[model samples]
Target chain A: MSDPMAFLLWVKGPMFNWALAIFALGTLARLLEIFLLGRRPNYAEPRGGEWGPGLRTVLTRSVADPGTFQRAPFDVLVGWIWHVGFLIALLLFIPHIELIQALIGLGWPGLPNPVVDAATAVTLVALVATLIHRLRHPVKRHLSTAEDYLIWTVTFLPLITGYLAYHRLIGPYPLALGLHILAAEIFLIVLPFTKLTHIFTAFIARWYNGAIFGRKGVQS
Target chain B: MSEPSIERGLQALRAEIDAPVAAFFSSCVHCGLCAQACPFYLETGDPKYTPVLKLEPLRRVWEREFTLWGRIKAGLGLSPKVTDALLAEWEELLYDSCTMCGRCSLVCPVGNDLQYMIRKAREGMVASGHAPEGLIGAAVRAVQTGSPMGLQWKTLEVQIRHVESSTGLTVPVDVPDVEYLVLLSSMEIINFPEYLEAIARIFDHAGVGWTLSTDCFEATNAGVQIGSKDIAATLVQRIVDAAVKLRVKNVISPECGHAYTAVRWEGPNLIGRPYPFHVYHIIEVLDALRAAGRLRTEGKETDRLSLHDPCNLARKSGVIQEQRNLMDLVAENFVDLEEHGRYQWCCGAGGGVSSNERADALRRAAFKRKKAQIEAVEPERMVTMCATCRTQLEEGLEEFNMDIPVVGLTEMLAEHLVEK
Candidate 1:
């Protein structure tokens, strides 16, 4: 734990194991609770089919509606920008894609360094703006739980630290790289325990909602 | 009834914690977007009225009773407690402010069925004796006198006689094996007698055989508004029994939105069996008749008019297109309120809000959204299918000093019917 090189090895080895285990198990348990909490079967005769609307909503609900966008334009724009940016930064970065490919056997052509760097920058700005937004808005501030802030900080740290390390802005490469991995490990451990679980649950929720509405003959 | 208490309320809430509740709680991003979609929040600028926050009691119940961390936090006094005071405070938010219009559900980014949870949350509120007095009175009258308005069979008989005289057609009562068994809301029975006359004329013109039941003609369900499925099931059972005994092929719900929901969507679920007869909103039946060439009308209205899609009819059930299709048939210059169909703004009178006096001010305030939509179009008259929406539109427009009249679509269509 004393030498910077040893810390980097620990962060990449045992620390990674612990974070990945918690991340995988915690998310699975939460997802299982939702999908398996059974109920009485619906007895009413359905007016229309469920399958079409069920999948339709899961795909369509990714964007906010116009009424929603009008009231919270900043939120809608920044939120989408950050999510899309995160995916790009995660999937299109050569290093991250190599890591994922080595583990999962899935590989795609990585975006250019400059393009990925730009996306990472936007994502970082959006994350900070969203934090400021939650602090400023009365309703959003009230709804913010401790977990919300914790998850936001943990998620922001890794991305910001990675960008800083890549450009050698925060510290020497090894020191900054160790901290980046450390922050990411924390994010992985906390992801499933917090609202970040919404990534897996959002579609399950939308499908359930849409199917019920569709069964009742309404397009949700 | 036993004096309502928090223990009973907690037990009732525990029963509603099924798969959907867990999933919705899991998926809420807490972005506060639903607050913008809510009329209670939009009109009053109150965060507590956000559809998701109104379920705080239910959410607390889910956390404390279900989740491991929630259980640990709750044991150590980390999570907020669900108390009698909380239920009392949420009663207004759950009942008075919410129309159960399902608009918030439509707008949720994660697609949380906020309206569905609000309906379940009312079970806790009612068990805690936190329901509005107006809704409670409606429930009692509905159970004891067979109509929430306390209109008796004799009253409808009088309307029946008046309709028979006006239309020169007998208003069939309790006739077995008719193609449709028409049901009326107590509001329609006591207030809009012309609805019965209009139906008589339209049915006679189309030669569509239909009958009313003396045993159970009331379609308004006070149980639904009060959020007691036990009472709702009891009322719905009466309609099922009547429909089954009469052997009617279809049950045509009157122009009452929740009545359509209670009898059509929630009825079989309440009764724990599939209905032998199909249920249709009056507009759906009218649309079918029009499609089949049974509904023949000669003339079209010449003024600019628009339609108000009742929340239950359009959003809750998929009857949106039927009303618009019917409107196209009869109105020469029909214009749509910018947000018509499933995205339509509520008249703020559905979900039992109109029955509760405590909600009157909030109802009018919420109606401003619809009122503005009307002004945007500036129609000469506003037409709607549900009688509750019709009544609320009339009252809401009057309150705002806007003179555009509200007419029931069925009556307007009857006026233009091809003469028998």
Candidate 2:
């Protein structure tokens, strides 16, 4: 904890491993609980099939439904921006791709460093806007719990720290990188345990919604 | 009935926590976008009306019993428990404020089925004795008598006689192996006998074989609205038994939203078996007859007409386009509400809200959204297929002095039918 170089090494080695282990196992356990609970077989004859509609929903739900865009244009726009930016920065950045390649043996082409940086900057601003909106919007403010704010912080910290580390803006390179990695480790560990689990469960939920509505012959 | 207790409520909640429920709970990030989709929330501007917030008690039970981290927190006395106090607090949110319109389900960013959860949560609420008295009374009458409104077959028989006398067409009774068995809601029987007469004329004109059953004339299921599976099963079984006795190929649910939903969609699941006969909303049958070129129409109404799609018929059971098809045949000057079909705002009297007297004021308040929609369209007459929606529209428009007369789609369609 005292020496910056040694701190970086400890985080990069042991802490990273622990974080990954917890992330994988915790997410697995959460998903297993949902699947194991099992849905009852619907006895009614389906007017339409579930598979096509379910998959369509998985893609279509990414956009706001009709009237939703008109009612909360700000929320819809900002939500799309942050999610798209986050995905670009996470999946298209070189360093993140390298990390994924190292861990899962999956590699893909990464965007330019400047492009990644731009996405990170916009996503950071969107996250801040999201925080403000959550605090100020009556419905969001009322619905939010302490865990919601905590998850927000957990999600925001890693991105901010990573941005700072990439630019080498804080203290020393090793210290900044160490802190960024440490924040990310914390994020990975807390994700499956908090509302952040939506990262995975949202698709499952959308699929179920689509499938049920589809079987009823409704395009939800 | 014995007092419904917290133990039974918790057990009910636990039983209702299936995969979709679990996924919905886990996926909710509390963004509160669902509030924007809700008529009650939009009209009242109450954050408490947020669809996700109404499921708090059920969510607590799911967390405490299902999730690993939740179990640990609960064991350590850190997580919240589902209590009678909480259920009591949510009764209004669950029953009065919500119509189970499924709009919230359609608009949730993460695809959370808030309507489904609310419906499931009502099961727990009823088990805890937190259900509104009006709904409880309706359920009682529904079980003790054949109708939720306590209308006996004698009453429907009177309506049938009137229809027969007026149309000069015989109303079939318990006729075996009919093409369809038509079931009427007490609301339709009491408030709108024209629905029966219209169907009689239409069937006669189309030469469609249909009959009324003496065994289970009532179509509405108070149990489905009350969220009691046992009661729902009993009502559904009666319909199934009647349909079986008559040997009907199909059963046509009258112009009632919940009745169609109960008998067509939820009936099989509630009875734990697939129906031997198929079920259709009256609109669907009429549309099919029209499609088959059997329904010959003579003329269209010149007045401006707009259609109100019942949440159950359009959103819940996918009967949206069928109504629109019927509207096209009967109305020369037809208009649609800005928010129509699957995404339409509820009439605020569905899901037992109309039956629950405690919800009267809230239901009226929620109707403001639909009122605004109707004002925008300014139809000469509002045509809708659901009896509950028709009643609510009539009452709501009258309360607001909108001067709009609500009419049944079937009746209006009958008015345009060609005479042989």
Candidate 3:
């Protein structure tokens, strides 16, 4: 019970439950708070249908428009790289797939180990570049509060720790694995409380934006 | 000062926060892409002009009242409160700089509607008596004298008489059961009486049944520009009453961008009911006439012409292609600015920036983006649908010592109309 393996077991058992509970309940409470606030009915006659544009923006906003790309190429390109890389490593890695299946009874084929490893490396690099850009760019630097830097650290830890655990470079296998799990647990706990809520709320925000402009017959 | 208070400002901000605003505030990741989209930020190189940061007070109110973490922080006196001093500092950001062009909303990576929140933020600013003096004067005059610039009915009567004498067409007033009730802005009545002549000539050429209502001819909504729903509703109600009294099937908003937005987009919502008749921008009416084969033309302008899309018309209300259709009808060599239509750069004087005299230099600075766009095309003459945009473009081009002249789209179309 006093061994490093026991520490790994404890992280996977009791600490994991606490993290999951906070993540689920906190997310639900935040979502409920938004929905309960309620929107007023628009009495203006609509020029177009809402559903089509609302659905379109949810997918289209993933890419920056040409004008936006030209103005801020670094932000747009690096942002895409990080998101794509992180999603691949999170959903396509073999162990993550097994964890998802264990939790939600959903299973899918996993990517090869090398592909996942490369994605992890790319994601780590992008995250660091993102932080440097935040510190350097005048607008980003001015707009960023303490919460932004805190969110970056929390998001960066798990990917780096997972990469180290896979390579067994930091310590023994159980000790590295336990550290990775602990980092992930901290991320999950803070997800609902901070700007990390954008994971789900982005969809809602895009739909509302699309619908409002759509009602005016514009493709926002 | 006695009329507006911090307590009322806080309440107004709390009342303005709804589901979409909640989602927008929650989704923002501070990516700063919105700053790139804003002409003011680009022109001034000021981090304070960033579009998303313009909503700081509103965001603070949203956080302090809505979120659990924010509530906890507030209880501990950790989070900043939305005070009158904070709103006073933000007055220039919200009113003097932003044109409410919605470009920030278009370019946000998280799809945050940053301009929408800024519009809401102005409500609090006004409630706290932190609004610009020029805008406050305009709003007060609009409510008290039925004209933001204090032009009375007799002033419009002089223009009507001049339009009638020149065009040799009867400019009917108070005519009931007409198909369209035409409205005008005081700017057109004072600065550009040619707009009235153009409307009379165009309507007569098409053989359309339209009349001006002496009951209410002014369409510009300074209340809307000042972000006061109560005053906006009062002004809107005057138009509604005029339209109902005339029993017109359609009402036409003049060649003013904010007036079109006020009547066509926010009119019904402000008055709390659907309009009995439809509201159309004059360009929309003109385009409809052309499409129906009613508007015949004789000749086209030979020189190179380019268009400046008004932010409220093209970006805010989707009146993009209609202007182009009208442009094609009258101009043989019409070129477009590099970025026109919904993605066009603002003339930097809409959304009450022009009304706020303190923003004169800032607005001129912001016009550098539009100037650069115009330089790329080198048009002999620039055309626009909104009167406000035309004034700004004219002044900006003159300020830069550019020889190009600005003209109204409707007046340009009227010049080429086929003789009856």
Candidate 4:
């Protein structure tokens, strides 16, 4: 058999160029979304104190409620597992690492092959579990729209294709790799357009909550 | 188990909703983030009781009976059967378990309005004659009589006279040509008369010309909370008629959260035009007084206070900051609870959940989150701007045996009011 690395190089030449173009365009689109669609100041003006104090109060108290996270153990477990798993897969994927290394000249010590493989497998299972939850649960199923299914599909494709490419499970490693890269690029393009945008906004919400409660002298 | 008249009523309401309600139900993308925001979901670990899942029956009906996609799914046998038993079960889940607190909406990524949907579902139940017997009975009495408690006009008169004698401030009733007409909920007159006393003292202190109408003084419209527009309309119409009759410049809705929203947001629309008189929630009135230097308070420097934002006032009516301002003037030791303002936690008492005996367990479960929040502050007292929330929190504290004082924002202000 021909060297898989050779095929990878050939695909990389064109795929890299396509990835860069989409990355630039997608980043630009995300920025436009932040500036245009995301600029509404949903916070109300404090009727008593200035904005500064109110803002301070919101920021401080959100962190103070460490106990809410503690009390709702199942929620915290699910939330953390899903969020952290998604972030690790998204940021440390080989192609994404390559992009980061190329753009910023930074690299982390790679995880052992077995660990990487196991994490990827676990993440895929968790994603499936979450999707099933949305389907089987009557309340969640009721609230779900068609766009929700689209997000799940878009998110799932990259992880699945990337796993297939890593294991060389398909006809050729190169083809799987190219599909994986393409899926990821498409996800980036749609990230801000869908409910996935909650990733960026959740922290802002958390911190705003912390500060508001902090100023009020309540433990977040 | 089946009453023909009630079943007929429910069928008519479900039929009347038409397409828009169905469309909204069909648009839910369940990320479960709303689950995190729901107090019931947090305490019980029961996903079935989560705010998002609570809307399933409506969603199923929309899919199977209303939407084209739903019709296709039903034709294919892909949609589950929605039997009368299923409807009965959902009646318990949707009406009895959920608190329509709107917290879920704030955290919802798509902004799926669970509260609005639940309210519509309750309206449907009321039409079907499936409403909780207590709510329906109270509403019926409210419509036939003037107040939910069935307090007679003479009793209201004595309550008014009592306020005047106790506070050395005359609370005028049925006075024509008053500049402002104040409306009090029967709960305030009977359960928390200090709220009425606070209002009279504040108005007297400010020298604002205000009169309470003995005929239509109760601000609470149980219809609004229970999702009966007809009953809500009847309650609000009385206030509107009195405002117009009294020739008042403004109508002040006391520190009742749902009452304020009903009159301010729905009152004008129900009346079919903008009301001639301005409607102000008591918090707004207090903020105005503090701003204009008319209502002065010696802040409680020693006592630590935390403010619980009521859902109706904060999310529904957009009066989030007004309560905070009132808290600041009234409490020197005020600490803002986390998730304050629009993001604040529900007191687990809104949307008529406080009145449903069957829902008490779910209500108690939901209250755990708010209690945790209160304990986090470790404040000497937790102050609120809504009367129902005050009742709910106080009741919850007693039921749960938590050490926290639940007082109205008006009550707190009255304690700190500058003596003239």
The DockQ scores of all candidates, in the order shown, are: 0.73, 0.87, 0.84, 0.09
| Model 2, span B278-386: residue lDDT tens | 9998999999999999998978889999989999999999999998888899888999999888899899999999998998988999999999999999898999988
All predictions: root-mean-square deviation over Cα? 1.3, 1.0, 1.2, 8.4
Off by over 4 Å in 4: A1-159, A162-169, A172-220, B1-27, B299-301, B400-403
- Give, for candidate 1 chain A, the lowest lDDT window spanning 10 residues: A32-41
lDDT score, candidate 4: 0.68
Counting only residues 3 or more apart in sequence or on different chains, how many pairs clash (N, Cα, C under 3 Å) in candidate 2? Answer: 0
- Writing each residue's lDDT as its tens digit, candidate 1 over B158-249 gives 88988887778999999999999999988987668788888888888888999999999999899998999989999999998998889999
lDDT per residue for candidate 3 within B105-191, as digits (tens), equals 988888888878887888888888899999999999999999999989999998888888887889999999999999999998887
Best DockQ among the predictions, by candidate number: 2
True contacts kept of each: 0.67, 0.82, 0.80, 0.08
Candidate 2 chain A — worst ten consecutive residues by lDDT sum?
A57-66
Model 4 chain A is weakest, by summed lDDT over 10 consecutive residues, at A38-47
lDDT of 4 by residue, B1-420 (tens): 566344554454455343224323433445566677777777887767777677665666655654444566689998886555666667777766776777665444333456656776766666655677667767887898988878777887787788889998888877888878988877777778788888888888887888877668878878976777778888888998988888998899888888887787666655566677788888888788888999877756468888888877776666777777777776678898866776678888777777777788778788888888887778888888777888888988888787788788887778787798
What's the distance in Å from true for residue B337, model 2?
1.2
Relative to the true structure, candidate 3 reaches a TM of 0.99
Query: How do the candidates rank by lDDT, highest first?
Result: 3, 2, 1, 4
Backbone clash pairs for candidate 1 read B255-B387
